[model samples]
Target: MELNYEGFYRFVRDELNVDLNAYKEKQLKRRIATVMKSSGALTLEDYSELIASDEVIRNKFLDYITINVTEFYRNKDIFTDFEFILRDYLNRQFKNIKIWSAACSIGAEPYSLAMILDKNNIKTNEKIIATDIDDNILKKAKDGVFKDFEIKNLDKKDLDKYFIEKENKYYIKDNIKGMVSFKKHDLVLDKYQKGFHAIICRNVIIYLKSETKDEIYKKFNESLVKGGILFTGATEAIYNPKEFGFKKISTFIYEKI
Candidate 1:
């Protein structure tokens, strides 16, 4: 039989319980080819068998496809803008705010928010919800350990205040770590929690298809209350925000209508 993507897609769906079809076709195909070559599999069938038999290979495949690239306060200037909005607007509007850091990778984004909340003394009724589809990544996030580079963007004062440096690795303080809660969540397949004062979902939907992106945006709009904030990635801006019941409040920031 000729090597084809359809069969590989089916194998992934059945075995992994992940919907590969939600991602962009070209990107998904390229990732599959790279992983297959790395495993020394000449055919897709062989690769599928290898993944099924080896737990490590299965995890490796999942890790590669999930895209866990993240850093604390990624895009510092944009984060400053978010801080301004949170302090000047959201905090005043809602007495006890609720925030969701969707597709939170390695706890950086949510922890970043936690630090902001701590520094500025923002009151939240509940812990910030940080979620990702990959269980292994979620485990690492819960551990709250980071290398020098991961926390490089953070300033010295915040670093000293929020993290403990031991053996050259920074460990998040329990106080800040306690502010955010990590959970396993698949953005495409899972249900979104509602009544969020602000939802930060950045740098993720760019890898998905347009329809999938549209679906996620619609769901995000639904998930937020009126006038709630939707902070998206720099590259993932909604050109026609009105269609999604949002108005462009700032660069990569939207306010729900």
Candidate 2:
């Protein structure tokens, strides 16, 4: 049989439970092609067979597709804005806040939020739920050790307060680490947990198709309480926030209405 992209997509869904249809087709295809080239498979069928039998190849494919590029306080200006919003908007309404860091690669975003909460003195009994699709990334997040480059945006005071530096690596302090709970979650397939005071799903939905992004936004709106916040990536702003029952609160911040 000829190399079939559709068949390959189905095979991946069956084997990995990841729906490629949600991802932008052109970008997904380009990534798949790169994997195929690296694996020396000229045909999609050959690559699919290789992935089916080889654990290493399968994991590589999963990792590549997930796009795990993250850093502590990524897009520093936006996070600065978020800290203010958290203190002024969220803290005032919710006494014990529940936050979800969806597609939270390596835990930087949630940990950053935890630090902000700590700094602002927002006493919350509930821990932040930090989740990602990749199991390996979740493990790394649990470890909470980061290189200097990963935390470049953090100030010296915040660094000294929340991290212990040994050699060149920075380990998150027990207090900060304890405030976050990491888990493996696929945003496309998994049902969203509700009643969140805020949800930070940044730099992720840009890779998905418009319809899929819309569906996820709607789900996020449903997942949050009325007047809850949805903090998106700097580049992933919702053009029509009202469509998803959200009103634009700031540059990348949306409030559930």
Candidate 3:
């Protein structure tokens, strides 16, 4: 039997509440096919049936589809630029700040922001809201435990300052962990929260379709307050900042005008 891509997409939408259309079809279909093959399903229909009946299979399917490759301070240079921008913005603006780490996988990005804040001595009452579509990843983020490789970007000083090494794993200190709150959020389907001083949504949008990416950018703009910054991944720079009511301040950083 032939694999019905449309049928599988519909099944995922109705069953999982994830819109496959938001992703580029070629890449998304290839990923879905790979998952189906790995699961030993002969066709999309078979795979769909298997996922529908098996909770574990469904969860795996969801995990496979969402791109979750992230690390603390993934791109060091961009983060350095972000620190300077954030400090300058904070000094010029309000003392208290609210930041949203959209599509934050495993809490690294938000926790990184928290560490930067702590290092700079920025006192804020609000906890950083870090959100992802995966609940399991969110749970891991809340746990604040990471492997040695995940902390590779940090220098010795930072490592000692922010993490407690126990056996083979590194645990983020309470001060950093206390700065963030993790929540499960679907960027494609859910409503975005508003009035954030900054929104760091990096790398995640590259997997999305152009239209969906534009919609998300517009929503990010709406979510930010005036003069608020939108920090994206190095490769995911906005071609037209004015279209989204954003002014390009630096590479991968935009301020809402």
Tens digit per residue, CA lDDT, model 1, 27-109:
88899899889989899988989999999888989999998999999988898999999999998998999999999989999
- Model 2, span 1-257: residue lDDT tens: 96588888899899998899899999999999997899888998889889999999888888888889999999998899989989987899888899999999988889999999998899777899999998888988999999988999999999999999999999999999999998888889999999998999999999999999999999999999999999999899899999999999899999999
lDDT of 3: 0.90
lDDT of 2: 0.92
Measured with C-alpha atoms, the lDDT of residue 179 in candidate 3 is 94
The lDDT values for all models are: 0.92, 0.92, 0.90
Instruction: Tell me each candidate's TM-score.
Output: 0.97, 0.97, 0.96
- What is candidate 3's lDDT per residue for 201-242, written digit by digit as tens? 999999999999999999999999999999999889899999
User: Given candidate 2, what's the lDDT at residue 26?
Assistant: 94
Instruction: Determine which window of 10 residues in candidate 1 has minimal summed lDDT.
Output: 1-10
